[model samples]
Target: MLSMAIGDRIRDFRMAKEPKLTQEQLAESIGIKRSRLAQYEAGRTEPPLTILKMIALALDTTLPELEDEGVPVPRKTKAVQDAPMPNVPQETVDMPYAGLVPADSNWGDPLGTGEELPVDIKFKGENRFVCKVVGDSCYPYLKQGDIAIFEVDPGPSVGTIILAERLGDRACTVKLLEWDAEAGRSRLKPLNEAYEPPSSSPGWQATAKLIGLEFKHEGVKMTAIEPGGFRSRQLAWRGFDI
Candidate 1:
């Protein structure tokens, strides 16, 4: 079962390092704040794949080994003679992430990251945001480990799948916005029968319309282009969700 919390996996891998790196050590190595790294380890926040990928690199392990509960990959790879180098993004932003929000996580006000992560520019726009998927709530349409891109639309039309949040509860969920003509309102509908529909409260509202989704992979992020780090990996979302 993929039940292990990602935070725990990060902590385990950090400690399992030969030198047993401290939060400060790891954070420093990755160019992030120790407090931020602390939140990831403590579960106060979910680290997006961009951040998680860096963590994997610093810990001398693969991203899958840290994020997946499937078979573990061996750590301490001594050579990569036959392996292709990782594709690190040059022009990057600390793109906000929303889950594709964890299925079990409940958030508090301001929705930091808004639930956001760094994304490649193809998905960038004034209203677009990237979300890392960690649950099977969207099932066959949007699988776990898929990174979904959504366009901010506070009023997405009925029948559109959306990333929504309940202001009163500060909870985020992905579902189809269904029109209930009889009730003269809309309700969230679950496409997959295995999951329950999202809560419908007065504060419940659409935040963005689902647009794109891609399988997750390890890639470094940089705000500025580094000399000699000019390689690019232009991956399009496997399919347009909308």
Candidate 2:
């Protein structure tokens, strides 16, 4: 049987790579089809020992690390290539457009939705703020058009998906937060492998806390992005049980 846990780890490590190995690229490197890689990632199939070893090499990860069950598959703390920061709006003021708040803005108070999405008002608190996605770095799970609802300074734990800002970053980004107390650094893992992995140095501050995501789809609904770094809709529509 395909182990969902293992598959989840495989997918995370693939995305956590320095440059990120796409399904197609990783499959090609291992002499398999992209569909097979997708199946392996989705937990529909388990790869053979040989294929698994190849995957570890292709992702620049150790096979022992892959085989270890206790280890988090992507372990966001791992170092990867550095990427340029994205440009974000400097305005902290709340815009009139759909209750959208910029990440850099002072979001001490809850933003006004102005009757845009049918968000669960119960979750709206002083700590929660809504910020629009600025780039495609976290695609599939978080898109450019999607609006992110974040909780400010919640003191997130390891493997929490967050919308945070690094010291040298121009804007806040959506990433999986992994803390390394020994090294005094944090790794910000992106969902999209095309973009490079981001991390935090000393004096890193989370710009906003990622509570959930609001996607502008056919029907206006609220979905919490899972820590697995995939859209909740794709995972059998188990929306926002978190």
Candidate 3:
């Protein structure tokens, strides 16, 4: 059976809230084509990230709130799966206080002590690099201390949840990639409810590229980042929950 589209839910909400506002009007206000809006409402196409944000804004609700289904919500918890080393190898020296180790090492048992630890590492491979997750921006799917494996490649497709450097910032952020072809622009969309949508400037827009993603590691939930999938309670981190 076909799964229920989130578009349908969005349409139902829009119609219920603004019966007088035609689809064209709504589309105009939201910066999307009227036909595209119709496609979204009819479940023919998924609404782009921008449109989703616009809809949430127009509705005076967060994206998570707009997409929330009134059901018994599941608790956000992490379960320890079998910890395995990825194909990548450690790049640091065997001795401490040297080069950086493979990011995957943080997830593995340090010194095989059998004691769980909260840490992350960064690695430089011949062709790729990796960085572990250290915060809750991608909570539920990526725990506060889960180690994420990221490829060094900087080209990620639209809708791909990726690890990318925030435009004009020293810090990095994990968010979904949204590309606009006509405008030659893109945006960084956070899964967390607390984060507001980030727009890329023309300069950063051109160079901002996806580094990689938080690969499913042991002791981490492997849920995909979807609209309204994860919720945040605070706004401490720019892209993560406090």
lDDT winner: 1
Better of 1 and 3 by lDDT: 1
Q: Give residue 143's lDDT in candidate 2 (0 to 100).
A: 54
Error of 3 at 35 (Å): 57
Candidate 3 runs further than 4 Å off: 1-126, 181-184, 199-242
Model 1 alpha-carbon drift over 4 Å, by segment: 1-94, 99-118, 201-203, 216-242
Better of 1 and 3 by TM-score: 1
lDDT, candidates in the order shown: 0.58, 0.54, 0.44
* Model 1 TM: 0.46
Best by TM-score: 1
Question: Which residue window of length 10 is worst by lDDT in model 3?
Answer: 93-102
Error of 1 at 219 (Å): 14
> Candidate 1: lDDT of 228?
16
Ranking, TM-score, top scorer first: 1, 2, 3
- Model 2 segments more than 4 A misplaced: 1-118, 168-170, 179-185, 199-203, 216-222, 225-242
Pitting candidate 1 against candidate 2, the one with the higher TM-score is 1
Question: lDDT order of candidates, best first?
Answer: 1, 2, 3
Residue pairs whose backbone atoms clash in candidate 2: 150-209, 151-209
